[model samples]
Target: MASPGKLDTRGSDFARLARQITDAGLLDRRPFYYAIRMTIMAAVYLGGWALFIWLGDSWLQLLVAVALAVVFAQLGFLAHDLGHRQVFRTRRPSDIAGLIIGNLGIGLGWGWWTTKHNRHHANPNHEDHDPDVSPAVIVWSEDQVARSNGLPRFVAKYQAYWFFPLLTLEAWHLHIASVKALFKPEAKRRGPELTMLVTHFVLYFGLVFTILPVGKALLFLIVHQGLFGIYLGSTFAPNHKGMPILTAEDKLDFLRKQVLTSRNVRGGLFTDVALGQLNYQIEHHLFPNMPAPNLRRAQPIVERYCAEIGVDYLQTGLVESYGQALRHLHEVGAALRRPLPIQGA
Candidate 1:
């Protein structure tokens, strides 16, 4: 019944919990389930592409493009699971599958994404250390917003309102980031990833351009990218956005850190399928390699343990989760508006 703040994850309490969860067999890999899911998603993606091909220059092709984007996003979800080794036992096979899904299926560099995501898992919401919290167009904390200037400062002022709108460009942003990472010398053995990513773009553009005129192809690209961005961003943004952020100087045990820095979205099968069970963000952070299906089962145990240890466990509806993130952004930005106090006072 001790507070998580006072408990060390390396101590017996956490070890016992982990053992219990593992002994419960909730951490079992579900390779067959993921294999079937990926097969179906791939089929759907190709089907959507076929529809776009058949529809040609008609506006109806836009629908197929959107559908294709959705499939791509789902494939992205699978790639994420593969990266965590949730669907596979061996790291190499998981990496290979993630590369195929992320690079070829969605035009993302798997190595780049894994590197970034592993950092996030290791140090969630650490102002300086966590890449996820690093300022892009929006400042994440009061100190960050205070230090901002020019366009970023202006963007931070209205970030809460602009957040969703800005996310429409995330798909494009991710694609560009991936492409850039492929060229980075430190990205590590990226030859296969680069090839797959280039192949994705070539096939993606070649098919669209072949099926439609230049103008229609552009529109299709916009719609596809926009929808894909929203889908992907919406799933990921809620996981840790509004939760308590850590600083590089503030150290905590892994159990407390993950629990306090994460938020869970409440939903059933639909949410699980859409978010790849990342809605169980706390548990997912605690047990990254656990299969998506097993996350739900792990949730109750995690919640119970957190409750017993007096950790602040957070779960909210999808809309509420977004609102929490927005509120956090707005509050952080508010610091920029506050006038400095006189030194004499």
Candidate 2:
């Protein structure tokens, strides 16, 4: 029952809770479930785009385009899973799948995405690594929530308005240079990372210009891209919010930090429908190789781990989760100018 701030608590309490959770055996990562989920997302992306194209210059084309945007946002969720390595056994397979599906589905640069995502896991609460830790999405820490000395912080906090307007494309372009560096010679060697990016731009551009009418292309972009961004931003922000941040002094391992810092949202219908097994974040963090669907099954085991650690495994409904996310936005806005401590993943 001790709060996360309690340092005097013995490790035995945590050890016992961990044993109890593991003994319960509720956390199981299922590969097959993740596979099916990925397949579905791919299908939705393809189907939505195709439908928008087929609709041609009609209003339906615009409607479908909007849907296409939404689909892209949803694809971000799937990409998040693959990035976490929760969808497959091997990194190559997961990376390749993420490239093929994510590129086509969300116009994401797979190589860059994987690198950033890994960094995110490595520095969950660290400002330098996790650019996604913005007021536009996740809530900020107390320092992060404090006001800045100058315009950059002011612009960042106020710029959130433009976040939704440009949300779909912002992630890629906003962090372009940083992401592009990720595909440099050393990084690019990893399955020719940026190679997939060229292919993605080519394919989508070709489809938009040649295969589909100009009107249809425009519509598809609106629907699918919008949907994708909204969903992507929403789904990812909640993972770290409402949980305590860990620092270098914590002396915890990767798995322990994941349990203590990352949390599952009882996503209910959206858990399976939108995120596949990501709803079981604690288990996914504990065993990245486990498939998404299997993560749900691992819940009981995760519960035990929480108990042993004397840390309450956290979950809140979706509505409440977003509200918390919004709070994080304010907190993060405040922390812009403050110094953040280094921490392990």
| Candidate maximizing TM-score | 1
Predicted structure 2, TM vs. truth: 0.74
Give per-model TM-scores. Answer: 0.93, 0.74
In the range 1-345, model 1's lDDT, one tens digit per residue, is 766565556745567679868999989878688878988987887788777777778989888878877888888888888888888888888888888889988898888999899999999999988999888787888888878888789989878988989988999999999989878778875788888989999999998898889999999999999999999999999998978878867788888888899999999888888887899999999999888888899999989888787778999999999999999999988866678899999
User: Could you give candidate 2's per-residue lDDT for residues 1-345 as a string of tens digits?
Assistant: 345565335455445444544565533445666667667877887787677567655656656656665566666667767777656656888767777766544566666666766766666765445555544432355544453445445544644343455556554562354346655776664444455556667777787767567766665555655655666666665677656655456676655667767767785665656654566767666666555555666676668546645555777776677676556554555545456777872
Which consecutive 10 residues in model 2 have the weakest lDDT in total?
A: 134-143
The 10-residue segment with the lowest total lDDT in model 1: 4-13
